[model samples]
Target: MNVALVTGGPGAATVGPCTAAPSPDLHYRLPSAFNDASSKNGRAMPIDLDEVPSRGSQCASAGKRRSWIPGAAFLAVLFGSIALAQSPPGTPPPASAPADLRQSKGVLLADRPDDTLLLAVEAFDDGSIGLVVSSLAPRCRVPEDVFDLPVQVDRAGFQLKHVIRQQQPQPDGACAESIATVYQAEHYWPLKTATAVTLHLPWGAVPLNEAGLAYLKSITPARPPPALPDDAATYSGLLDQLTELLAAGRNQEARAAAEKVLPYFVQRPPDEGGRFFGILGTARRRTSDLSLAAASFEVGIRLLEIAGDTHSLGVVSDNLATVRRLQKRLPEAEAASDRAIAAFESLDTPGGKASLGGAYNNRSLILWDQGSPELALVYNEKALALLKVAYRDDPQALRPFLEDNKFLRKAIKTP
Candidate 1:
């Protein structure tokens, strides 16, 4: 059995140190029941990853699903054809496909043989997640490579560069020097973990050959995705996809997707109230779904402790508080702001400090709305103080999140 750990999202997967140890059942793929699975602090580790096929297995088991992976042979065919540019005419392509085709890799779920090698496992506040064939290549690159000439830099930019520097390929790493191909690093990552890790290829392209696809498909089956909230604000999948789309510059599509998914929260769907409200709130606010947005954010905050991310509860609380403050809902907003501020301030990481300060700035908005400009001033002062002491010297480290001059004004306006 093999597992690969990956993280990104609003909540932190770093919450529990329960043990990276996989259960014995997970150590090897058994036909039926998995062994003693451990749930850290009561929340099962989203220990998502895939188990590669054991080399010693009989040839039959290595390529066929019932023979090996339940539906792998099917995936092998699709990806095989795709890898060789053999797609039949009229295959659907996502909007970013043509321009980004050579760089994209994704899993295909065709009905022919039925087995698949791709699975998306998400753990909130950590990172969006997915799995795919090891041989699949990635099209995404580090952001700084946009210049026609080498980007000019000095000590300051280099210092700021370390924030996400480790993500770049290193001299000794397995990936090739060229940005166009990623075969080397994929071969080098340890895909064998006790728990199964899912593979997440790009949407328009397949990265491997039939043999490689078939081999990866033979690895393992995914546990079904967890129950999703009916409301739009808190829907993990929608938000994750939206964020990815936004980053990829497919904004029009993301806006449409958000509009389709987030409204269920506005009316409070009976079957899934709290969950729906949260996702709806997030969708509304972020996608300009403002009127009912604050209400949705509040519901999400209320559902936090029961949800996978305790940290996001804090984030939503702050988010809802901001919307409420914007709309003149003073009392509820103030209480929410207090909770949000306290939550971020309690943690020690640089992220925690920055988020905590953001909470303060958000709180000031509420105070100003509540007819207490004086208190608002105090909170603004606090936000500026934190930013200066902890982030100003290397503010560029904030990158795409806070690089705009308009955003920088927060620090100067605090006084």
Candidate 2:
């Protein structure tokens, strides 16, 4: 599922601990997709989040299993960027629909300006061009108070206006939120090529269309990625347990369980393998450890390749791109986002649709860093719309946490 919510502390509150020290109640239900119970040490102890060592370094290795796959969860806050996925080569040509998209009329699909990575853009006979902006982060303009000792309403309003302008919006509907959604839908793109380019005004609605997001409503049954080949039933059961622990904010316990499930990860089906690695990688990042997180994603990507899963690989690539961004390797970061976007565009599964959010998230970050927060708002909204669909069933399942509301508001208002 897709993911965030702000006011960022532990991201979620916990009544107690979530440890593998004890078996979860037999009749106890857990959070949807995330906290994995099976990943715990064989003891199945009821190690709740409250019981785990809160002071333990989030990065401290928890004795990983030799057979474990790469990951358990992701922290939406670690690095400050999002993504933009490009359409893949050999896909059906697009038709005019939204201003956000255009055909590649005369322009060539060159490699990313910073990275030497060869791009896979498909130029159409039509002249309209489609450029894949990469490496997105979804932070509202840095909160005014984070800088000044005191808060200024006037300054806040100014920053808010700046954020709104980037969305380029016109309100619709009676409800502000609904109106914002419709306004954003104006910028929505649905696998189509468009003509309009330059925006005369800085303000416009980011795309958050009802139709474009229809796919999001169709949440897949809490199933693992189809490619995962291990004991699907087993991994599925374990994943559910882990999610419960996470939802309740049991980071340490969740981490422990993640390790126990590692061995089954390598040969388990592709979707599951990549997904596991992606989760584990995220868990590492939540603790502020970038190197291991990057390694986890790399391992996940390798597993997905073997599973013949182009879509999951794209997701892993996005994960890798974000990790690179944290390492300050802008060039590599951009290329990874590009590849992730390309991979998603080339796929036909729901994962492809959901993965677009990650691309937009990464791309938004890149724009924000370039002194273009205005543009970043538009892309951030796009990712928000996608995440709404993806995480409708399960939002708070990951660690490090995401600012779902902050980003959602950012999506609606752009400023």
Candidate 3:
């Protein structure tokens, strides 16, 4: 009964091409499910990754075949750990960790409890080492001390100590629910002679397995630069500026900025042009300009198709469907939703499956709003089935979608 009604517009998870470098400042918030659940009783209960249900258990309850597909945001967080080495432009750098706590080369350590603590060590070509420490905690209880904690490193390994403080009652005597918070700290050290390194966290010690050690050792001090068009840097800078504006929730400014720079990408490669259009569409949608949003997405889809970027194509197509739905263009919305599902189906990857489920959910909403409750129910069930598989390990993340499905079913059953 923790379900909240699905009001307002559809969920807007931003999208970009998989291979494109993300803006260093771009930070994604946890899904609305977490936000909603945290505030339900004013007790800010964040989902602990350690308590996630087993895949077999979740699948058995859903009565569907279990499939493992990582959510898009989940994967993004994993990859984003490495990018944390440098603070965003204009942000003050944090206090350095003690001298003994030298950083190391970037390698994702496995064999730790998922989503608890992530440590990414990156070795830069400049002989500098970077370490990014990340952990999740309740919004009101961030562990700011993790940044300055001393790390002990020796030929054997490195050890970092962290202790989560208990949540003290708020000044108002009640903790307000807020989105789950991720606290991260970056530290740098001078590179030293190559040595096998192990990370000892408070929970456990994780050694660099053979592959990790080899990867750390094999990193070239410098990489050959790829040939680039003269305007590449300018183009990248423009996109980065736009991404920053959007991430900061400056919707009107982002729309204007996107429009100003969009023409530059028109004659570029399809992927480049498509990426611009996608940003433009997102900005327009956030500004409540549905017509322009749909137009941008349509153009982006064509360019992505020409570029053979099915992932971005699926994403833009879904965005178009949502815009068209808001515009009450049922036929067009349904067609766009179908296209998105088809594009995701072809990819068959974990991110693709997660997106495919979202497309199904979009189609259900469109059908229901178009007065086809029966058909909507069918699509909703299909969406739930796929999402159950996609989020088998993190059922808490699936709560919002489940709540939406429950609402849809109840509405359909009502006289």
Which candidate leads the pack in TM-score?
Answer: 3
lDDT of 1 by residue, 345-367 (tens): 77777766776767776776666
Indicate whether candidate 2 or candidate 3 has the larger TM-score: 3
Cα-based lDDT for every prediction: 0.37, 0.39, 0.49
Worst 10 residues of 2 by lDDT: 174-183
Q: Where does candidate 3 have its weakest 10-residue lDDT segment?
A: 177-186
Instruction: Please estimate how well model 3 matches the true structure, expressed as its whole-model Cα lDDT.
Output: 0.49
Best of the candidates, lDDT: 3
What is the full ranking by lDDT, best candidate first? Answer: 3, 2, 1
- In model 2, where do residues sit more than 4 Å from their true spots? 1-230, 267-269, 348-351, 370-415
Provide the lowest-lDDT 10-residue window in model 1: 157-166
**Estimated TM-score for each candidate:** 0.35, 0.38, 0.44
TM-score of 2: 0.38
Q: Model 1: residues >4 Å from true position, as ranges?
A: 1-239, 246-252, 259-280, 393-415
lDDT for position 96 in model 3: 26
lDDT of 2 by residue, 1-415 (tens): 2211111121222121111222233233333223333322332223232111222221121221111010110111100001111111221211211111112111211222221111111222332112211111122222110010110111110000000101111122111000000101111121221221211111221231333223223222221221223346766666656655656766555555664445334334556656676666555455454554565666666566666677667877887777666666667777877877788878767667667776777766755555566676667777777777777778663211256336544655733
